[model samples]
Target: MITVDFSRLTVSPGDRILDIGCGSGRHTCAAYRLKGVRVTGADLNPEDLKEARGRLTFHDQLGEHGGGAWNLSAADVTRLPFPDACFDLVVCSEVLEHIPDHDTAMGEIVRVLKPGKPLVVSVPRYLPERICWALSDEYFNANQGHVRIYRKSDLIARLERAGTRFLEHHYAHGIHAPYWWLKCFVGPTRTDSPAVNLYHRLLTWDIMKKPRITRFLDRLLNPVLGKSLVLYLIKRRL
Candidate 1:
């Protein structure tokens, strides 16, 4: 499911977009669908990069990329391989909380993004994430799991210090927050719980069908209960 609202971000033909920590290519592929853009999906995991490449290739086979070019790279967010000021847009979703040196990653994101270009960064919202952490330790203790929980304002300030001007923020996945709370209560790894399974199915249906009722509820509840906090920012020129 897509989190960044494309309508809030401007895109022009020939713009180059980067999706850092682009697991499974969700946001990367979303950017690729824009007309005449060049999108790159970069991740630290070779396996994830492989999967992203496969998805991009599948999109090409289905003629769904809107004539855009795409590539996948195995790259660390803190030490990206691209030249400075290379990307017109950069997306770093659900990634910062996992890095111990997230400041460095933010710096790299600012460095690679063209001056005055936009960057979209997302992470689990503090309240919902705190609830999950309180409910279950395993939820945040897994390998490569989140190491920090950021209050919305703190994250915005941190990014601003890294040379990006915060524009606005939004919350997403309101309905999914309850599902995760339930999962944490039942044990994050417990896939056998019937309640968790049912919730999972409901989420799957919502993502696939996007029924009007769920959509309305999601939007209505997002400001308070959304699972993810997304921020929009623009890199500042030196």
Candidate 2:
């Protein structure tokens, strides 16, 4: 399930794209399928990188890559390995809230992105995330879990301060918010709850089937109940 809206951003053949904290290569593989783009999926976890590489290889086997080149790297967001002004586009989704030094990571993203290029950043929405935190400590207290919750205004200000100009914003995963709330209520790590299990199956079905009713409801409710907030920005020219 891709969070960043490709239609809102411009990507062309030969462009280089970076997916920071690219857990399991969801966005990385999405970008790779754009045909002729060079996509890199970078994360701090070696295991996640390995998984991403496997997924990318699977895409290659299935001929789903659209002729794009791809690579996976184990890298920290706060101190990336790429050269300055090297990437045409950067995607940092569901990642910043996990980092204690998110400001430095933001700066690194701007440093690597070419001036005037687009950057997409996403985080859990404040209301939904706050609800989860209120519902259960385990939701946020788990290892590598979210350490902060971002109000839309604060997040936009942060990225703007990091040398990116905000363009637009949107919300996503509206239907999934309730599923998480249920999990938080039941117990974040518990798998035995029948309600939670049922909801999980529903979500999995929606993701795989893309039924019309669920899609309509998801779009309808996204404005107010969306779990994820996605922002679009462009790096400032020096």
Candidate 3:
């Protein structure tokens, strides 16, 4: 499920893109399909890195992948291996909350992103995430799980402090918020229950069918109840 709007980010075909904390390489694979971009998927986990590479290889075999270059790397977000001002675009989705030193990670994003380029950062929205935390302790207690929740303003302020110019923001996955809330309510492990199973089926149908009703409902609800908050930032030359 692609959240960041490529058009809004104005990605050029040959642009260099980085997907930091690229677990399972969902977004990185998407970028590779953009055709002609050099895409890098970086994560601290060796397993995730391996999986990302495997996905890229699979895409290449199927001929569904792009013509551009793509690679997977193991790297820390707070201390990235890239040179300063290297990438044309950087995507850090659902990642900041997992880092204890998110400010340092943000600084690295700003440092490696070329001046005037875009950085897309997303996290769980405060209210929905707060509700999840209240409902289940398992939600945030896992290894490498969320350590903090960020209000929109606080997130923006921190990015600005790290030297990124605030551009704009949006919300996504409104339909998924209730699914998670239900999971939290019943216990994250209890997906076999009837109510949760029904909801899961509905979500699967919505994702597969893209029915008009759910799409309309999600658009209406996203502003108020989106599960994720997506922020756009630009690096300023310092």
Tens-digit lDDT track of model 1 for 1-238 = 8899988999999999999999999999999999999999999888888899898999999999869799888899999999999999999999999999999999999999999999999999999999999999899975258899999989999999999999999999999999989989989988799999998998899988999999999999899999999999999887
The per-model lDDT (C-alpha) reads 0.93, 0.93, 0.89
User: For model 2, what is the error of residue 168's alpha carbon versus the real structure, in angstroms, after optimal superposition?
Assistant: 0.3
Tell how far residue 174 is off in model 2, in angstroms: 0.2
Query: What is the lDDT, from 0 to 100, of the residue 67 in candidate 2?
Result: 95
In candidate 2, which residue pairs get closer than 3 Å at backbone N, Cα or C atoms, i.e. clash?
Answer: none
Instruction: By lDDT, rank the candidates, best first.
Output: 2, 1, 3
Per-model TM-score on C-alpha atoms: 0.98, 0.98, 0.94
Q: Any residue pairs clashing in model 1, and if so which?
A: none
- Give stretches of model 2 more than 4 Å off: none
